[model samples]
Target: MDKNAATDAAAETPTQDTAQEPPLAGRVALVAGATRGAGRALAVELGRAGATVYVTGRTTRERASEVGRTTETIEETGELVTAAGGTGIAVPTDHLDEDQVRTLVGRIEREQGRLDILVNDLWGGEHLLVGSVFGKRSWETPLADGLRILELGVRSHVITAALALPLLVRSDAPLHVEVTDGTAAFNRRYRENLYYDLAKNAPIRIAFGLGEELKEYGGMAVAVTPGFLRSEQMLAHFGVTEENWRDVIARQPDFAIAESPHYLARAVAALAADPARASRWNGKSTSSGELARVYGVRDVDGSRPDALAYFEEVRFSGKPGTPDDYR
Candidate 1:
């Protein structure tokens, strides 16, 4: 179904359950940035498929990380994973610190013995996206701030994969998912900020770079992205909760195409289960909507909205029509 049809159907149905056997049973997975958003959702979804998930993040119930505005901690995400039926272990580690990340992986090796899936989702750079002339050229933005984005967003992914790839390669059919925003086709246009554009585009390149190395060991890596995600912090931005998010669509019609983190979560889960078809997606820059069409999984209230398609046609074109047709 298209985005609009799915959204309309969601409004009519209270719930849509697509039942399946636990495909990931006996598997082990790790999400490096499981504080919230895509990382948290990926952990829970993997658990739902019966994979023991190691969730790592800086935030805990005791103290918050740099993104301290919200209270959703890594411990909470781990608990949610366990509640969903798989073992969840929450380890507090600052991904920016290579030593801390190495130690965390060591613990996972000690406990799980093998790592089947690795999700490098450690993005804590949003706190530094500040400046009067933000989203300017590389020379325009503060040099330190721009480099800081590379440190938190790009370097952290490299560090986590550097340490974790060894263990992952030992597995039967390992999958590495590098989460980012916008697909390769969508991000070709300059995102305006040097750091912002680089940070977002690096993951796409990582998948291709890593895929070359991983091919030797029959391992795979792909950069994954969600459509406009209605994450917890995003909900707060529109001054509404998930329960009442539809209300904001009136003000910003494009909001109608926004999807929950679970959409991407399930997308990765589907990938983990279908390792035989790994070559089809290896090294590709993909999104939740692209996978949803293939897997037939549903999003919030079973609605499948494609934010990229809407953004490309409507948001980018500056069309003055409502999202009623698109989503």
Candidate 2:
């Protein structure tokens, strides 16, 4: 289905329930940087599971951030979450500003009393990937651009977790999801750019260190990555729409294993709803494909695309196989 059709269907009738009550009924969640992509989907899925979600981002209907895209806004994300069956509150926040983060957390605490899930998905450095970052040595890259990437992808996550954890720990079952570009194992090799490498890997360590700290309070922290994600920005990059993304596979063969942002969003919702997530996932790094398999969840198109496995066994390894074999 198209995005609108899915939203209309969800708004008219909730489909995330198989029991008497939605799994996350009455829970409260904060999805940081939910203006678009996986973060936006995460907010909506959490709402579908019956959790009140506070979605934050730098972009609002009134303004756009440095990422430069104005088509999507946090206000629209908030509406989508509410339409999906939970309370959605859009809060404009620049996590790098500690004061803004502190106020955001304070408002959540005042309005909800406690936070059940914290999803740190605040990276917005993709615009730096082309001329500014890629194919350059650390010495060759622009210092300002490199630092901006770290500020957006790494420091923001740290700031959000630091300010939000006090309220998050108060919940009976708290989940902290550090969303990043690649899994710990996958990122062992250099990511072609020094700054990008550090930016992505930092979240994995954040989850590990936070897990150690949060365990004492009965909270779980895990790093999660999505496969070749077909995000809105990515679709635009490939010059295709979600409904016709297959047309680009001929030029970009690896795109065959691409999964929708909703795949990772569902994985996060499953993690939030799982009673034993602390024992099973705390301090570990995982991917949407791995979680989907564990939770028996499928993507919107009804397939579980394991892009990492495909890359490791086929693309990088030069094994003779098609993306279909992995997807």
Candidate 3:
């Protein structure tokens, strides 16, 4: 829901050893909250697979959203997707507004006739995490900030899915993805703050319910989470660029396993391309690391960084091991 870099190499449609065509050559996808981070990368990756991707978010070159950052915009995401060899349309949308979401779905239906993929990656609450969620109890947190997180993370996804599903169900192999912060298993424990926990868990439930409802239509829905993501904002927080990200690992050992936003994009793209994805992943809650292992996807650096494994085996379990052990 939130980072952005699309490499030229990544833009080129990846060909398999068998000389297969781009898997999604004639497909259409809508990536909500694609202004930056994982959402932006997912749009670009889908384009690389030859899907015409509609990239939507509140940030644009002409206007900034409450997120307040001007560095990444939906227009730039659209351009990146186009550069990746698929048509990219930038739509400025506030998903919390039902009318706006309806208009978006109508426009998509008018232009594309059907939607193959619907990605709800709408969270933009990183700015509110520090003081509002990290160390506060549910009641101790500022009511407005906590409510805003729910608005961005929960309500937005619901609105988008409700409006978009009608068009999505028309596709032959519709795939709905709910992008959240943690896998359902990992999130069984409290995610620091009560509001934040609920915000993240809601998507998983939404995906499950949608999956069940879509079964009759031959559609698939799954919730996915990226492992210790090396988002643009995360890099800045560590005072390092991606090129020199390792320099800060000594200060934050867990950063050693941080993965690029592209990893999650690759997972979703793989899901979109798989013919048997419904059987493989429908109604499931998975992480990028798990998908990467199953689909043989590697990070941009060519390593499969399993942040969940690292946390479960070493960080949380008190095992004697380094990030290298899991990655």
Per-candidate TM equals: 0.91, 0.95, 0.94
**Which stretch of 10 consecutive residues in model 2 shows the poorest summed lDDT?**
8-17
Candidate 1, overall lDDT? Answer: 0.85
Q: What is the lDDT of residue 108 in candidate 1?
A: 86
Kindly list the per-residue Cα lDDT of model 2 for residues 56-172, writing each as its tens digit. 999998999999999999999999999988889999999999999999999999988999899999998899999989999998999999999999999999999999998999988
* Candidate 1 Cα errors over 4 Å, as ranges: 1-21, 130-133, 317-322
lDDT of 3 at 34: 93
In order of TM-score, best first, we have 2, 3, 1
Please report the candidate that would top lDDT against the real structure: 2
**Candidate 2 overall Cα lDDT vs. reference?**
0.91
Per-residue lDDT tens digits for candidate 3, residues 4-95, read 22343333324443366688899999999999889999999999888999999998999999888888999999999999878899999999
> In model 3, what is the error at residue 214, expressed in angstroms?
0.5
lDDT of 3: 0.90
**Each candidate's lDDT (Cα)?**
0.85, 0.91, 0.90
Better of 1 and 3 by TM-score: 3
Of the pair 2 and 3, which is ahead by lDDT? 2
Q: Per model, how many backbone clashes are there?
A: 0, 0, 4
Residue 243, candidate 1: alpha-carbon lDDT: 97
Candidate 1, pairs of clashing residues: none
Ranking by lDDT: 2, 3, 1
lDDT per residue for candidate 1 within 68-139, as digits (tens), equals: 655799899999999998899999988878899889889989988999999998887766775522556778
